[model samples]
Target chain A: MSETKVFGMTPTWRRDVHTHYCPGCTHGVAHRLVCEAIDELGIRDEAIGIAPVGCAVLIHQYMDLDFIEAAHGRAPAVAYGIKAVRPDKIVFTYQGDGDLASIGMGEIVHAVNRAWPLTVVFINNAIYGMTGGQMAPTTLLGQKATTCLSGRTAEANGYPVRMCELLATLEGPAYIERVALSKPQHILKAKAAIKKAFENQVNNKGFSFIEVLSTCPTNWGLRPVEACQWLEENMIPYYPLGVFKDFE
Target chain B: MAKGRVEVREEFCKSCGLCVAACPKKVLRISDSINPRGYRPAEQFQDGCIACGICARTCPDVVLTVYRIDE
Candidate 1:
């Protein structure tokens, strides 16, 4: 039998570096999907990436692209400035839950509300991964973190922000979608959604926001596979998945 | 007896078992031998593989590579 390689090691955007993520963390999967989308759309050369403070603060080490590290929770503002000046480049930002929904909330809201033609890849792992499992603004109720040892309660913690729904309420964004990296089928769909977001910017559609529900096994206190199962069982229900809003 | 072949980049494997769970053919398993990084890597434990690329797709570490075989 002759074997034809359907999938292999090289995705042009992926650099040759050891991934430092935890055993079960899906950040690598999320990175791969993002790379695949860029490869398909042929935007690697013109793509400019903005990474804010968090686990992926040094994301440029893994992916071979021009990257800028923004102030904590301020990637969206930086991205907007870059896009405004260099309208020819495809500007995008990769942000984490705490950075995007918490500290950078105002930056993101205003950027999307202003309708900047930028692609935002938001990774929501619920808890703050790099800072030692602290509760994030998107952390679900009943989930325990170092900051909230007992569990997140509505009275004490307030509520998890549904970013897609929140941003969809505004009339600025051209597209808003939430997808998970828990399953292979879902990963495929995630790749498509992300590709579409890049396409939107390439076609000069409008601001595109793609929320990725990811896993943090070490921080979540679960095995890698178990954390994925937990995401499917717990996170997906509250976060939900699908295109919350799309322009045409 | 297999219609597809799979290979795992063991050095990069994080021993997460995501590929094992994602494989529909049940061909991959965590190997007993640990890699240089001290984590057990995934291996092809059986013969019935359809090479659907699910393992590669689900791998969080970008470890698995799938190939379709033509006789």
Candidate 2:
């Protein structure tokens, strides 16, 4: 209790609990951003978060707000259902790459195409972190995972899918951005993007999606610091961070 | 005399060392004490801290609580 206690002591949006995320895993960073965005916007009371499959499936345990657990890759659909009936409440989906880009791809496309007034936090860590590091739809080409021990090959594994770019091409989205959590500066920007996504809904600005390039150090087989460096070095180049579309 | 200070909830820290790396002032170091989780938590170095909160923001686990010290 000193210095008048100006800042930093666990935001009110999240419960003060020990998280299950691996040490240095960017899912921790991404989770805090979501929680902070909700608290910062003062929408915690009316916000409903839909978390689908992957590592964040149990995020409901961490966040204090109401959460709807959707089937893997079906968070968009769940978000749509909630927003459709209770339009007054803010609805968002926190999903991983495998859930958002692969299995639940159709749900997301349809929800965006329909212009659902929802905020989507897409955590893209490339490899499938929850299932022993399998190759995900967003897995970087030449990146190695348990499923691709020798590195992902073009002929065998195809190519990485850019979610922000793909969704930007759609006619319905109000905002689309791809941000990363590699450093403090980038995390600050990511926080801004997430807050903006929620703000868009509060202002009735149609659909918003933020694709966060996160790190999975435990699965990636790298130290936490090295994984962050790896993301900045490799993922940033291919994913190309920035706003793909604005809230126009 | 530091302008700001940080308090680490040691039990919650995973000893990932991200905070140590992110600290621009080099004021944090992984401690020798091992928690029940078997990881060394970071400790604040003596003085020289600007209370920039970069270490707090960069932490994956919400373990660090940064505060600005008054006069």
Candidate 3:
């Protein structure tokens, strides 16, 4: 088969820094966005990326930007610290649902409240992908994960946190949007939002957050394509994508 | 004969070999040596290619482009 299936995508970064994500996980898509944003912003030299725990811990390895690995749920705080000192450099935090909405909520809320010049790329797959698919704060009602085999019950487990809506309540954020990377069209929109969030940082704007409702097929127990479909059908309704709030 | 150009932008590659491993055409290979970032760059056998974008999709970096040239 002499099909044009030769070689990997040439090194936009490096080859050896292999990702630890499961097949079909959208973390890779998110990583590429960070790289593309840095490349497009021409800030590869002056960009600082803060990677949070919960599956995105190794983001430092994939992105070419100067990366700092933050403690679980503390990326926003670290990002705030960096942006405060190096105000000239662009700073962004890539976080997952558990890391953002769960233990790190206090830090993130305070940071956004203070209107820090930082961007947050939050990945919401509804379940914890790295730690064996536990129920995450963003997990939809009735959704099943390893910890919620019988499905999530609000009486015991609490409600799914709508981050876009939650963050929108704060008037200081410069931009807020929810997007997905499940398909080509959605991926393009996600790229635009991600890039814009970074650009907001460069413009010395207040906090910007783009929540990406991503797919984790391996954790969700669906095929890669099916996972995307599940997201489109079940997840999109609960977490609709749109501009939550934008500041001029 | 029309030839499609498969451009691999080395800067975007993470070189996990998913494409090299997934390609049924076996036109992709990882170099023995590593780059400045300590990752191996993928090598292409253009003669054996059929201009499929599978490698590009499999590539996490989105670094490979398959250009279909009109004859």
Report the lDDT tens digits of candidate 3 across residue range A1-248: 14343433333454556566665677787787767777777878888888899888888777666889899899989988897788888888899999999999999888888887788999999999888999999899999988889999999899899988998998678899999877666777888999999898888877899999888887888866678789999999999999999986
Error of 3 at A177 (Å): 0.6
Error of 3 at B31 (Å): 21
Q: Which residue runs of candidate 1 sit more than 4 Å off their true CA positions?
A: A13-15
Docking class of 3: incorrect
Clash-forming residue pairs, model 1: none
Put down candidate 1 lDDT per residue, A1-248, tens digits, no spaces: 57788786546536457888888788888888878888888888999999879998878888877898899999999998898899999999999999999999999999999997899999999999999999999999999999999999999989999999999999999999999999988999999999999999999999999999999999899998899999999999999999998999
**Taking chain A by itself, what TM-score does each prediction score?**
0.97, 0.97, 0.94
Q: Which residue runs does candidate 2 get wrong by more than 4 Å?
A: A13-15
Tell me the lDDT of model 3 at B18: 53
For every model in order, the fraction of real contacts preserved is: 0.87, 0.69, 0.10
Clashing pairs in 2: A3-B70
Model 2 Cα lDDT, one tens digit per residue, A1-248: 44745346545435457888889988888888888888888888899989779999888888888999999899988888898899999999999998999999999998999997899999999989888899999999889899999999999989999888998999999999999999999999999999999999999999999999999998889999999999999999999999999966
Error of 1 at A100 (Å): 0.2
Best by lDDT: 1
Alpha-carbon local distance difference test for all models? 0.90, 0.89, 0.79
> Compared to the true structure, candidate 1 yields what TM-score?
0.97
